[model samples]
Target chain A: MMNKPFENAIDAHGPTVLRVCRAVLGMTPDADDAWSETFLAALRAWPDLPDDTNVEAWLVRVAQRKTVDVIRARSRQPVPVDELPTSIAGTDGIPHEADPDLWSAVASLPERQRLAVAYHYVGGLPHKETAALIGGTTEAVRRAAADGITRLRTTYGASAAQEGTR
Target chain B: MMDTNNTPEFDLASALTVGADEMDSLRSELARRAADDNLLDVTYRTIDTPLGQLLLAATERGLVRVAYEREEFDRVLDTIAQRVSARILRTPARLDDVARELDEYFTGRRTTFDLALDHSLSSGFRAEVQRSLPSIAYGHTASYGEIAALVGRPRAVRAVGTACATNPLPIVVPCHRVVRSDGSYGGYVGGVDAKTKLLTMEGAA
Candidate 1:
């Protein structure tokens, strides 16, 4: 066997792992910790994965499960969508590297919507894949993505339009 | 129609590129601080030897940072400064002593590091792995499994590998002193060639 299960899991869903961490933890150090923990868990369990399974969905499911576990264990106060920190001051005295507006918009999303957006857009998964991961039908995943994007557009639409005018 | 100038100043694409560049700068900054000779809150020093420039940073509590051939030493310096809540400056004298000791080892004049290591940043198994690495001795390499065994967990070889991957203090902690039992040089965050060179220099080949 080519270890396709392990390789596919990492290759196909690695970015999703980063996206979930980014969404839930909002660029905090805890996000990195969560990401590492998720991968470590995956590495430990990868050998048992069925060859015909959906690796991306499986990884997302694992990541989601881990994130929830971490949240429950830590008893973190739920950060209101508007209150999450979006821009980290660059560690080297440079300007912030991430697009602050996009990040802020992403950070302001409800937790489920945020996860759906990350899975669909950032993870490059189709609506079906996203639905499978989050335990919803394809239509529900589509609605979540649409709702999330609409909120981002509403929040940033004026700026986007003003730029268009100029 | 969209105006290019009024477009959001930052976005995901820009952030990823900028983050990568920033990380590079940070690595260089750390290296520069390590080479400076002024006494400051953090101990800074550089070692020049056959491998390349090596930066050693320490706090009163313990060794906190090390960088090798780093292009972004400043960022590393800034991170250390922020973490230790101390001003960072150059203190080559402190580092020169370390360099001299390393030089002796490279020339086969010394077999062990006599320097006191400050590892307050690491704890539990991570610290245990680092502590166990030096016991591998010079000119001998141990597998990750073997090191984990020494740490009292016979099955934690992979975790031991992770510990090596995350070793912030590489040379001093001697993560390069570890290898795979299959005789393959496993992953080194500093790059595999660097790992190979360190092993070859140590005569482990």
Candidate 2:
């Protein structure tokens, strides 16, 4: 077996995985890093992946894990201070790569709500799978997704529409 | 708003803060890393041609397969998966050299391809037959009996015909240069018209 299945998997679901990474990790270069790591890991495991696997769900799961790894790595890089400001701009810290307005909106969302929105809406997983992946019940995941979507539409969505006109 | 007419799901999914340029860059970056890590197996892409679309596939070794649209590209890919490896991807960069060469060949700017070929799909006497195809030269023709003689299997004329019919790498191998003993255009895997078109293009018709 070669990388055909792996390549096909990438082509079929690259955008969805990117969205999942971006949504979960916020719209930053870290999201790109997570996306690349997910695919690279998938490539290394391509030969062993079963042919009948649901590739979409598989990629989403991998992206989520990679996003977690990215977050962990980011946490390891810190400056000696009493308490780092939650909103560190381009001051003496590692520059965050993101559309500031876009990320701040998503960042404002509650963590579980953000994960619910990302895994369900952007990753295209059902509420059941989202719940399982995020360690919650289906009903909770659904409600989280609904609230997250409403919040995103008001914040990120409205800002995007305003930018498009300008 | 862009969402005025689209479905809610479509609107939500397409309304990402990341623009098209970012997405394109991300895809290229992923492909670059995949190729660098030697994870690419069977990469392919469609190229425009006078004979309709041609699906060009390549492996790390070289250009492995070139398929006509009528070949039902998906079915051809399945064959490649079975014969070569199941790890096929549609990466255009992997086929860039061969595609550019083929484009040059089509436009009459190049007479010979300067790229490597992977003939994994052919074997035995048929493989020998394929090896002899390029010697027939550009703008030239060779009879099946002549091919039979060249491969030192003079009596295997029908077998030669089969070899030509099943030539794994066609244009690169120049199987289109082979004709019938009676100086008639023989059968082609890409159909008689395509064969005729190739011959005409070669100025050997």
Candidate 3:
């Protein structure tokens, strides 16, 4: 088999996997756990991965399944906005000059919408793959991504645009 | 023509692009975790010949990763503060040792990784696989079944494959040394191509 292609898939798709884990597990430590588990799962299954398969989508599917398992095993509350670690938070965790409003808006999206947005924008999955991960149709994923983007626009457009204009 | 005042100044695509700074902050915060003594961080700097970038990261005892980058650039101090816990700080001078050794290896000057490894996170059979991998030697390959046999679990060849899949460290630990019994290159945590390249580079193929 093409072992090299498998390695390339891991490198190229690593961030997307992380983003998917982040979306599902929020900023909780479990997110990291899930991320590890997802890759581990991918490693075990890589020998069987179809040569022309969408590796990113495959990773997302594995990550989502692992995340669901974690969620099922735990009895914790759904991740709270306030509990998001500053490091993972939009601008509060780092010193780079980024638009806080935009990230906050992303962080503020509802869980489903947030996952959809992460898969679409951050993970770079198309609507079909996004749907598969989130358990919806392609059209539904498109709508969620669109809606999430719309929300980001509403929340950050006014202030960020004003700042840009000056 | 529409009045400029009535038009929305930014769209969704433009807004999303503005979050790169936020991602940078997140990366720095993640990097800070590497400094904790309890974190079991190992920094490796290697010239990735194919990607044409240097790779570095801090990992926990069993390879719980904190931060990684493809470049050798340093982060600004303020960014570090926001991303990592206050306990973490710029210690590039300390990391330089790793850089030096990695540089040697990339230039064909070093073969074995002489640095200390923190394998704290691994236990049971998984740890066994890690322990067994180093014995495969440079420029040699073994099958998953062979590794299983080496670990005293010949019946667990598939399980051995699982362990390799979960190998936290790739190049240093040399999971690339493992292959299929049928002369096939098996799975690699870094991806298949990376595995092939490592094998090809080492003349294992």
Candidate 4:
């Protein structure tokens, strides 16, 4: 079993994991932090990963855990002010410049629904794998994702559609 | 972007899309951090030369592999991951010195490469042949028979040629300095044309 260069793994799945992290965390900096931490952890364990592993699913699982760590740390610490704005300059959802309505809608989602939607829909993992990451039966995760999408339609979809037309 | 099922809403995934530039910056930061945290096992980068883009890969020990573009860089990387560790990245910091030295060598500002070389890819008779190649000097040429004799295997001239062909590190290891006994360029790992170009640049051809 030939192992692929970890760079290939990053190139293939970096965007997917970043999207998953951003949706789950709802803040650019924390999401970036989670993204970096997830890949770093993956790199550390990359050699030991079985060659038969689904790298995207594995990375999403890692990102899921790393994002939880960031969330926990966020609650324990004072909110950090942006110190190096230029470094993270091109990021979306940069607070004032972000779509407040969309951000609020996502923030308003129940944690389970948000995670299920992110892991399954955003991360492109199957509901079974998403359920494995977030802990529930696959059927329950499918329902949660469906419910989350419905909630977003009412809360965020209207404004986004109106903005698109205007 | 509305869902295609006659749903009157934006696509959820597109709604959460991260910009391509944003993802690039994030990946760049991770590459740097992976180096800092010492998780980058095989760092690689490419530099353009007269021979075209040359791929350089390094372990923490030193420069591990140098390959020409014709070698198919992706395939070379896969081979490195299999032979070395799979914990590899395209971080260039580790190979900065190697690339700089190569640049200097190509421009005729440097004669000898002052880079640490990892010889993990070669062993036995092949290792002996490669180990003696640098001693052939900058503008000097040696025949396969001469290299065989130098390595104490005068009867192993063909083996010397094989070593040069399979050399993991090429110009840096000075394998091109080994020529045919008839004073002609033999087969080279970077193709015969690259070998001729290097020899002409060194004023040996």
Quote the TM-score that chain A achieves in each candidate: 0.69, 0.75, 0.71, 0.76
- Model 1 agreement with the true structure over B1-205: per-residue lDDT tens digits: 3332133542332232235553334233433443342223466666776667777787656567778665356665655644553344344445665677778877878888777677765678988888889888888899988998898999999989988987878877789989999999989967898889878887887
Worst 10 residues of 4 chain A by lDDT: A81-90
Expressed as tens digits, the lDDT of each residue in A11-35 for candidate 1 is 3455556666677667665555566
TM-score of chain B of each: 0.74, 0.87, 0.63, 0.89
The candidate that wins on DockQ is 4
Candidate models: Cα lDDT each: 0.65, 0.77, 0.60, 0.83
Off by over 4 Å in 3: A5-7, A74-99, A136-138, A162-166, B1-205
Could you estimate the TM-score for every candidate?
0.43, 0.82, 0.44, 0.85
Tell me which residue pairs clash in candidate 4.
none
- Error of model 3, residue B42, in angstroms: 16
- RMSD each, Å: 15.0, 5.6, 14.8, 4.4
lDDT tens readout by residue for model 3, B108-149: 677887666656545689889987899988889999998998
lDDT of 4 at B92: 45
Give the residue spans of candidate 4 off by over 4 A. A78-88, A91-110, A135-140, A150-166, B1-24
Q: Residue B41, candidate 3: how far off, in angstroms?
A: 19
Error at A74, model 1, angstroms: 60
Measured with C-alpha atoms, the lDDT of residue B13 in candidate 3 is: 30
Task: Indicate which candidate wins on lDDT.
Answer: 4
Task: Write candidate 4's Cα lDDT for A19-127 as tens digits.
Answer: 7887787755888899999999999888888889988988998999998898788777787632212222454445333455665566567888888888877787888
Clashes of each: 30, 4, 15, 0
